[model samples]
Target: MKVLIVEDEKPAARRLHRMLEQLELPVEHTVHSVKEAVEHLSNNTPPDLIFLDIQLSDGLSFEIFDHVKVDSAIIFTTAYDEYALKAFKLNSIDYLLKPIDVKELEVAVNQFKASFRESGNPIHNKAQFQPIDLQQIAKLLNEPQNAYKNRFTVKVGEHIKLFATDEIQLFYSENKGTYINLPNGRNYLLDLNLEAVEARLNPKTFFRVSRQAIVHINAITDIISYTNSRLKVKINSFTTFDLVVSRERVKDFRRWIEG
Candidate 1:
């Protein structure tokens, strides 16, 4: 299938592109902002599907609809609250939260294919797709943001453990399990996966440095240059494994660390 990605964050865009490639669905193009997306849509043939981010660098991605007519099927990629996603759910539109899981992405793709087949639309026939109410979606997503998580609860061999977000130095996935590392050098396995854990944490405080790990701003002690344009981040009391920021994330990581 022909695919396009409209995402502001370079790392996120690249990650999504990689995931699509893994699914054997090669993306045809990628645009970073609403302006670029509008221009691309006006100038080139629209793809069969678009993996679109809600917020772009210039504005909400919905603005692109004002300038161009898009007929491609869309799957939203967003960090917005579930309440704000009512428009999508009501419309039978699909969405993937930030730190999207590959399995979930696959399910979404399969659903899209099934819908396409049911509609009997040819590969180049995008006009058969229904139009979406972009204004309504924008209004819903513009509502007040959801509260960030302040603490987490985990089960430890029949015992329960609760820890505040401030106590966390880092969260990492290992052997398909997610664990939180504390400043006291203690580790607790969380019930939620890294994607779910990341969705709850405040983006201003915690940044996902790589696919495997998320680090809190308060936990950072040193930023060292690493091989192949990546970065090595040192977290307080967490030394069991090295935390290397992915090359795709280095630019954003620098911006996050600066703040």
Candidate 2:
């Protein structure tokens, strides 16, 4: 029953620690932010289980997986009621939503103890550390019911033009701002940023390829291996483009391609 809690919020971390005490689980470590968690685990022993929060002050919680081998079970703790929370169950992952329900908490804990504590068969038993699989994770994303972008009419020069999801080639952050590039090779300046567009996109159709690119499904004509662990994508039907996938984004890109 040794546990490690990784959460950026002090109040939330303390509260989780208090609950762990009530559950009679020994708290081995409580580190805030991904950097601290990495340092702690790299220099010391890994814990039996981890209570992880998705968003941190510096980066996403998944960054920890990139740096270390997490053999222990994880229970995602987050305020996200949608995509992030949905990321659980897919990989045999558990989650405790913010303002965590006591009953739900108890149930998650019981399930954890039951699965990890005892051997089920006389034969060889496998450890239940489920890795985060992307195809499975894709199921967690909410699909666009109608289309990628909602209906919108905007003034184009002098006349009003209507736009739909399929009309757009991709969205990019230029000069630290967002803009939509249409299939007709026209770039429309937008106020929204790349991060803002990601959650709005249909996970099946649009992928956040890199920090600056939210590429359209149709836009991707071909993908070729690039230098290092990156990729070079040929965006079909584009005005002018030179988008290169960063090494860090390679994993998500592969997952999106496989999905």
Candidate 3:
């Protein structure tokens, strides 16, 4: 039986491949990131199995299911235990924690083979993420409400300050780190990425104008168009910055705003 490995971390993928080799299983292929996996699955026949990671550099492994059909068994590999618990509740056949154990790897593979014999296809029906997770994810993708604003208090210095979502005009990434531009006339570093914060915020008051920046709808002073299918947003923020809406995400963002 052939197996495909889908993981973004290079070392982890190599290690998993080595362990599977020890199992003497035929390896079909391996790829990193969600985009690469999509390309592979779109063109090639389904492998006998897939060892998938929960998180990719660009998106969640769950997104893979949306783009392609895979009847093969899947064993999720993640570092977080909370996700592992949820995976079990989803009826996933098996999962292995990071720094995968040889014994555990063998056990999961054995279970896959046995289940494949009994069920014909190892997957029950392509694992489905719970609705709550999907809703939270959608909220993260578009405009957000102010629900997350007052609940979170940050300690910026010797003083503990609370900044409401309405006080924040924009969220931007600097050196791959996140910072908040408050309309209250200050800029502060944020605890999480624009992605995580977007998911928790209610989707009525904020909009992710770009992959690295989210602007409060109330913060926008003007909108500008760019040459290459990009958008330039002028918002009431700490500084003047260029927000580029990616070409692939343009239509989705437009529909989201209209919807």
Candidate 4:
């Protein structure tokens, strides 16, 4: 299968190229920076698959998607752990944590071949490929080494107000936008998406109970057992929707609350 490698480090890129060569997969091209990668994809036909690195020289490789539409499937090779889980949720073949292992690369390649064989036409199934959410990636990568956002600024009509993170009870998404609720019964729209906002907040103080809500530890006044072995969380503020811990996140939610 035709493949392209977009990696910034020369030795790493060359090593990956050699690995693919050993496997006898046709390596179409190898580009270093996001700019060159974008330029190549703009002029040439997209490869069947791309072995992409998350952080490139100019910017994160996700920027290439912003410039052009790519039909190729992707296997992200990166040293960063934060975005690896999120990257797999996209139409990615696999995420290979770096200092690439030969066996892991082989397995990822086999997975791709299996999917490609099943799909019959890789290019036609491009609709399933979701572009990497760069905003969320940026938030994750820029997480504070020793600090989190202590306060946030929100615009209210004609004025901007600042609220300490401790003052906020919960952050939730509704009508495609994120909003934060306060103890004083005030709600303000936030500029960042729920995922981005969650990444910035201190995980110890806040827990993402569901895709729709990130609740502060102080906000949860009650946790009632709910249907399907899920949990119904009651916050200080009255919410129109039931704040339920999603089934998948239930275990972690329990650990967070108990701790």
Candidate 5:
């Protein structure tokens, strides 16, 4: 199959390419950022299939469809769970969560193959696939209430402990593992990764300060101006790691804090 990958993260794009290679799928090209993707799609022949990321470096990948017409089937790869419902409205064959599972990838590819076989020419037939309707999906998604996780179950040695969402001060990543800090001055290892944790928690209460940390608004004791237009976050009773929000995220951080 002629496939294309549009992902901003180089490492992730490379890994996905490698996985497709292992599956013996032909990945025609890989483009990072919305501009690059748009340019490529406008200039070159559209691929048969695309593994696309929702959040690109410039903007949402949805912006690409606004600029160019796409006939290829899309398989969305995303870290945020908020867009899950919207993804299916597009010509998405499947939606895969980040830290992509090989088995899941295989399954998604199989589903695409099955659809192709059944429809003969799946891309040209709108009945075989859903039309891309991003605006309506976005409007529906923006409706006030969103379901967020209230609690998490974590392992405490041999025993399992239930961690309440309100008790959590911050969620941080270290040594390739995610850990949750509580107001009671205790820390616990969590099986869910930082991306997963970010997606589940209430966005109003929790703000992802940096890639390494997601701090609760209540947990933030102080926010100080840091070097290079960045902001430093001080979490209550946690002093081991110094967290600084990246410069690019400063604007959203300010808005989040103000809200």
Candidate 6:
């Protein structure tokens, strides 16, 4: 299969490429931004399948469709909330949430093969696939009232403990494991990764200061200037680690904190 991947993060693109390689499906082309993807699609033959990310470095990947007509099948790889991705499900499109699972990736690829490959040529067959409504999806994403998690449950030996969003100071990932830091300096291990936690928490209340940590707005006691143009966040009680805002996210972080 001629596969193309359009993802902004190079590490994420590499990880997806490796996963595809493990499934014996080699990626023929990988582009980082919307501009690169549009240029490649305009010049070369459309790929049989495209692993597309919703957000790109330059702009939304939906912009690519505006620039060129694509007949290839697409499977979205996104960090968007489940509600935001519901449009894809309704449109009969498959999507893998961030920190893609290997088994799910295999299933999506197998399903694509069954649906498209079984019918002969996978490209230039508009009838076989539902036309993706990019405008409708963009509209769905812009809608307000997205449901966000207000509480989390964690196992404490023989029982489970429920912690409200207000009780948590921060969520961080370390040594390949995710943990929730509480106001009393207690830390509980979370089953989900940092990305999954970030997706569930309300963005208004929780801001991902860095890939390693997401801090509750009310929990932040101070913001200090840091090296490399990054900002360091101080949580009310969780001082186990330094919560530094990534350089790229500093501008957005400042705006979010101000509100």
State which candidate has the highest TM-score. 6
Best by lDDT: 6
**Which candidate do you rate higher for lDDT, 1 or 2?**
1
| Angstrom error at residue 240, model 6 | 7.3
TM-score of 1: 0.58
Per-residue lDDT of model 2, residues 1-259, tens digit only:
5688998766567767887778777688899889998898788776767888876777777778668766666787865434444556545566776545556777887777777667432111124543446444434443444224453333345444556766677888776556788766777754234664565568888877778888877778888988887898877655455778889888888888888
Instruction: Report clash pairs, candidate 2.
Output: none
lDDT (C-alpha, whole model) for all candidates:
0.79, 0.68, 0.68, 0.77, 0.77, 0.80
Local error of candidate 1 at residue 227 (angstroms): 31
For candidate 1, write residues 1-259 as lDDT tens digits.
6799998767668878998989878999999889999989999987889988987767888787778887788888876555776777886667887657678899988877787778844232334333557687787766546446666766565455668888888999887678999888999876455866786788889999989999999889899999999999998788768899999999998898778
> What are the candidates' C-alpha RMSDs?
9.3, 14.0, 10.7, 17.6, 6.6, 6.6
Candidate 5, residue 31: the lDDT equals: 95
Clashes of each: 0, 0, 8, 0, 0, 0
Runs off by more than 4 Å, candidate 5: 82-93, 114-132, 147-168, 171-204, 207-214, 218-240, 244-259
- For model 2, the superposed segments whose C-alpha errors exceed 4 Å read 120-131, 134-259
The TM-scores of all predictions, comma-separated, are 0.58, 0.48, 0.48, 0.51, 0.61, 0.66
Worst 10 residues of 1 by lDDT: 121-130
After superposing candidate 6 on the true structure, give the runs of residues whose Cα lies further than 4 Å from its correct spot.
115-117, 123-131, 147-214, 221-233, 236-259
